[model samples]
Target chain A: MNDVLIAVMMIVLTIITYKGATLVYQRFRRMYTAPIILSTVAIIIFLLVCHFSYETYMVGGKWIDHLLGPAVVALAYPLYQYRDILKKMVLPVLTGTFVGAVVGISSGLLLSKWTGFSELIIYSIVPKSVTTPVAMSIAESSGGVMSLAAVFVMIAGIGGVLIHPAVMRVARLQGQIGRGVGMGSASHAIGTATAMERDHLEGSVSTIAMVLSAVIVSILAPGLTLLLL
Target chain B: MSKAVTIILQIIGLYLIYLLGTAIQHTFNLFIPGSVIGLILLFLLLSLKLVSERWITEGAGFMITHLPFFFIPATVGVMGYAYVFKGKGILLIFIGLLSTGLVMGISGSVAQRLAGRREKAHE
Candidate 1:
């Protein structure tokens, strides 16, 4: 199949799968039944039942992946629209992201070392909180498995989804923007989704936090690793 | 005629937007991503009131709302290493799983505190 044709088809399928899962989520009200999880399951089942090769899936799926960039870029409008709020919030957002990045790295490395895992494993584990593309790139550069980095990203997403609600409740944070930003900065996309569930402003702030978290961690992780080592 | 031309132009514009994102990432040596920079650029343009939000809102909203699904392709790529699943991968998975909670919980707390402080200072 032609790559462009495949990309178009995949785009259609992505839309269908996502929409279908969202409808189910609306009916069920379960995070476990969330659209992304369901859509991923649907795709995986389709692949397994039909025995489609990953490469074949990639031919079409890759195109949708290409849009990931555009989606990130598109987030700017919401962030921009909320710029006044953001200007007031910038110092805290920056401080929180940097501190979170540092703590996440330090704790991850310390825990891995204390557990007696190999250095290679620690190298892979420490960068897991960053977005997948950046984390994977760092993993590759630092000699961790790219595929493993992808798994780490998934784990991070799922972790964010499950725990962030309880965390927010414990903090007694009624401020939606703070709640959402915290979620996104830590969990990335999944956290951002949770934020969207709360409200638009929260979602937008979360998206900004998620993006900022990735950018900051990508720069800091390597330098921190060097200093720590 | 102009309506059709506008639609065509918008599609072209979106494509150019994506490409520009790629170019910036390559050029500026950013840690985050070129696409993200493109998003920031779009946000900046919107904030400056240079671009009409009405024009891009629909597409952007669609993308942002479904952002989680975007990771599927990359995650699926991980299946290629099924053969080595037992070795160190298990540990890697555990580490990933364990640390994510730490990352989100701690970061969320810290960010909240900072945002709160800033809010108070503003008052």
Candidate 2:
């Protein structure tokens, strides 16, 4: 198939798959059935079965990937809507994010070093907790593969969301702010969406935490990784 | 204006802001990504009343509500990196999984304490 024609077909197929996945999630009402999860799984499986190269998929997939930039910018709307609560509870939000950023970087750095990963892998994993685009940029500049860094961010996010309730109970974390900060700083957008579905307060706080952590991690990760490794 | 028009215009406005962020980043040679700078810019605009909420509300809301949709492409890319599923790649990801839980737990605990104390003080 020609590239542009294949691109259109791929894009259409992906959207149809995503929509179907969304309906499935809505029908099941299960966390594991989330649109992102189901759609990604379905699409990946379809590509593998069809023997489509990842590059061919990207000819169309990049269109969707490109929108991530504006989607990130759209985060400002929630930040604006919830500005009052944010101001009132600024103390914990700021401090928690700072601590989380530090912990996220140091822990990844320590583990990667202890396990004897290369410099490239260390840099990629260091920004794993950050939002996707920011993590990719940090990884790119700091000598890591952008795509690999993105995958690490996805793992951090999906893992954080999957384990949220368990971690909350184990850590004895209660209240909307605490829940929000945990997922936001640690999981970014994926966690924020999951948190939002349960409670708006937690969701908005997660957004705040996500943005702050992105900034903090972007500034700190490379320098920290370089120094430690 | 019709509903579709409003949504389209708002999205366009958002894209413009994103472009401006990129322009500034390129001009000044800043380290921050353009999208993030755009995020900050939009928030500042909204806060300062330079941009009204209605202008961005609908479009931004739709985008944020379905934020994960954009992530699917990249997530799918993982299947291509067969190198990552073996040996140390698996181990490295396992560590990432563990560290993610660690971040959420410790961060959650700290926020829980401080936020609860603030409420008690107010009470």
Angstrom error at residue B28, model 1: 3.6
Cα deviation at A106, candidate 1, in Å, is 1.7
Steric clash pairs (candidate 1): A73-B39, A76-B43
Clash counts for the predictions, in order? 2, 0
lDDT computed for candidate 2: 0.84
Regions of model 2 farther than 4 Å from truth:
A140-142, B117-123
Error of 2 at A161 (Å): 2.5
The residue-by-residue lDDT of candidate 2 on A143-175, one tens digit each, is 998888988998888778777778889988778
Give the alpha carbon lDDT tens digit for every residue of B1-123 in model 2: 988888878888999999998898899987667887898999999999999998898898888767778778877877777688697678887889889988998887788788986645433
The whole-model lDDT of each prediction reads 0.69, 0.84
Off by over 4 Å in 1: A1-13, A170-173, A227-229, B1-12, B81-88, B117-123
**Per-residue CA lDDT of candidate 1, range A1-229, in tens?**
6878866766677668878887998999776776666777787677778777778778878877776667666667667677787777777667766777787777777777777776776677677776777778887887777776666676677666766666667655556556766677667776676567657667777777777788777778778877775
Clashing pairs in 2: none
Worst 10 residues of 2 chain B by lDDT: B114-123
